[model samples]
Target chain A: MLDAVRTARPRVQVITNPVAQGYTANMLLAIGARPSMTSSPEEIAAFIAVSGSLLVNLGILDRHRRDASLTAVEVAREMGVPWVLDPVKVDISPPRLDFARTLIGMEPDFVRANHDEFVGLGGADTGEEAVRHFAARNLTTVALSGPVDIVTDGTRIVRIANGHPLMDRVTAMGCAGTAVAAAFRAVEPDPLIAAAAALTVMGIAGEVAAAASSGPGSFAGAILDALYGLDAATILEKARLT
Target chain B: MLDAVRTARPRVQVITNPVAQGYTANMLLAIGARPSMTSSPEEIAAFIAVSGSLLVNLGILDRHRRDASLTAVEVAREMGVPWVLDPVKVDISPPRLDFARTLIGMEPDFVRANHDEFVGLGGADTGEEAVRHFAARNLTTVALSGPVDIVTDGTRIVRIANGHPLMDRVTAMGCAGTAVAAAFRAVEPDPLIAAAAALTVMGIAGEVAAAASSGPGSFAGAILDALYGLDAATILEKARLT
Candidate 1:
């Protein structure tokens, strides 16, 4: 995935939580993508105008933050630029889940959610059921990240039996995956292809991280090491997309 | 530096510009530092309460952003955790210089500045003169970064001359240096040692970047590669710090 972005530099605008802003933006840069992260609603139109893709993550959302995300999505829609929505922890709270559903109505080009989040957003009993619910929503692509990721684009579905269990131990790994998806979207026009590419890269990196670390504490660094070390040829060879 | 941070994980709070937020935070994580980047004044006190070190960067300061930096400094002061300030483009505008001066009065444990920024903050006519002027400041340590970096804690001074010219071609290289400094600070309590380690590491990586890239477009990736690839033995052998 890094190789793809390095080969084809893309301008990506990320409107995310303040917590992971620094790391996410830098990771995008390390992979050869131009990153812009701003939560100010006043700048959303201008940012979307210059960017090729948008990543919206509601990790730490508030009343004010929701407005910013809506503004960004509106501008992205007007510009005809693709955007990825990450409904982080939407299931844990009522207001958050309601907001996530409202955001879904905005017609995001792609939606990246973990098992719990997908269940919450889809109002499904299981991960597989959640994928089916999302598919029915007419999303361009929906990724259900877990031990095995399920990616679907309404009619077509690809299940990636890659990645490591250690990824579940780390906080914000799913958010990072969403950021990687946005990076892939910047380079590839097809949301389905981009989702597969990001999940493959992340899964390969997760496997590398699991081999190098003992616990969640050490896994984060190892994950970054894996991302930095992994190349396109290796990605193509190791990726398990079906 | 990465080895040290991996061994001793530290929680770092960064109050910085939105542009490099993702990359800087990720760089800290790559080296095993927990990074929290929050610009909300409402959350500054709570965030700094758990942080081991504070990093403030004046890269893209606007009227609304100044409040957050000031709040962070206030919280860091109350906590007594070591804080480093990066006075970026201080000379380019009056408001920026004034904000930097106000933050400096709050007493940062370390100050990381580029040649241009050092001269501007230290009230000196040249880079060398800025080093001399900053040596007299009340801060615990001052790092003046350029092709060669000079780190001083009043009595003891170290000069690191290892980076390449290509480093100047890239944007936010100084912010990366500042993030590295925060990483080092998270592990080592000594401000001088942390500043020296960060300057040496960033400089050596810059040299490595120069060897691999033709311009700024490629230098960014090469710089991260150099950082991820550098080891303590190699850094000590090649580092010009004295």
Candidate 2:
């Protein structure tokens, strides 16, 4: 799937939170994917329809993103393109949380979220069973990310433990991960494998980035270099997936 | 101004485009200044009124940002606080260009723009003379940035040439520079000195960051570290101001 992503160089429409537009676009580019980052209502529906996949990251929810997300998802659904949702900070705002639940109900192909976000999304906090239950109920693939990332689609479950704490220090790291997932999902048919493949690559990239970085500032740049430099062997060897 | 910023750690309200939200905040934090990035009209007037300075960066023009900028500027002016404007990509859209001219007429304390943006704002492209004329006519400080950065305020014109090419490769680099300028303007009484000091520090930091970075990605992180580590002597020794 990862190799396919590189070879195909699929275009992914990312309606990312304004904060992560640049990082998400650069992250996609580093992983050999083309990123179209236009959240404008006038352009989103058409842009998302033609994209290989769509990623909606609700990092900082506003009217613009809320309206754009609805339109983009409708078009993606009509066009049958895979999409990923990263519902960020859903625990804080009721309006934002409501919007996130609305997106999840639409059944994006994959969801990349952290513990708090998953919990806020009505997922149980009992680890594997909770992830599987949430995926089963939603009929969607889920990547429960943190120090160790848990990816599942109800039936099949996998855990990838490979990233560094420095990864968390960088801004919009999770949003960038969703962009990577959207890129991988463009080529991979199975949602389960696509989410895992993307997270695995990101985990390995994070570890590689941390090794060469002295602080969060340096990690921001090194991660892109690490993502660009990754080969099958490095991922295969370093990805602690089970 | 730089020393005062570090000592006081003034809060700056940045109505920046989504692309530079994280970078601008990080850049401010690195320089020992607090950054408040909220483009919500529900809160912008209050935020800007209390902030040490306000920086409005029109990197990606949208309704939310437009509304917030207008409100923030009004509040800042009423409070007698200094404000800077970064009219990004003003030449591309007529509507956007019209809005930029509107903002320029309000007389922001400082204007940080590229050569193209300055020209689009009706400034002649003949370098120093044009920059001075624009600043004098508008009764504002102007930082005309390019391979060489020209900071002028009608009467005084200074050129700073110390930045690296890699700085342009990073996303929102110019917006981050605007954030830096805002932080300096918060502490300095003179707008010309504030803009010049900020650009000189940014240019020197870019060179410092480029030395430690291998690519644009690493340069992003390295630049923050470089900004955080900058000292008066290092800036004085490395700055190329003529």
| Best of the candidates, DockQ | 2
lDDT of 2 by residue, A15-77 (tens): 877668889877887777877676666556556666899998888787877898899898899
List TM-scores for all candidates, in order: 0.66, 0.66
Q: Which stretches of candidate 1 lie over 4 Å from their true place?
A: A1-55, A59-65, A70-84, A87-159, A163-242, B124-136
Cα RMSD to the true fold for all candidates: 7.8, 6.3
Highest lDDT among the candidates is held by which one? 2
Tens digit per residue, CA lDDT, model 1, B42-157: 55666677777889999888765688778778878877877889988997888899888898888888888766776677546544545655666655578887656788777777
Clashes in predicted model 2: 3
Against the correct fold, how does model 1 do in TM-score? 0.66
- What does the lDDT read for residue B182 in candidate 2? 90
The CAPRI class of candidate 1 is incorrect
Off-target runs (Cα >4 Å) in candidate 2 are A1-13, A17-54, A58-64, A72-174, A181-203, A210-222, A228-242, B37-51, B60-62, B91-95, B115-139, B154-156, B169-171, B213-221
What is the C-alpha lDDT profile of model 1 across A118-141, one tens digit per residue?
777764544565576667665557
Give one digit per residue, the lDDT tens place, for model 2 in B34-79. 9999878788877777799999887657776788888888888988
Pairs of residues at least 3 apart in sequence or in different chains that clash in candidate 2: A217-B221, A221-B217, A221-B218
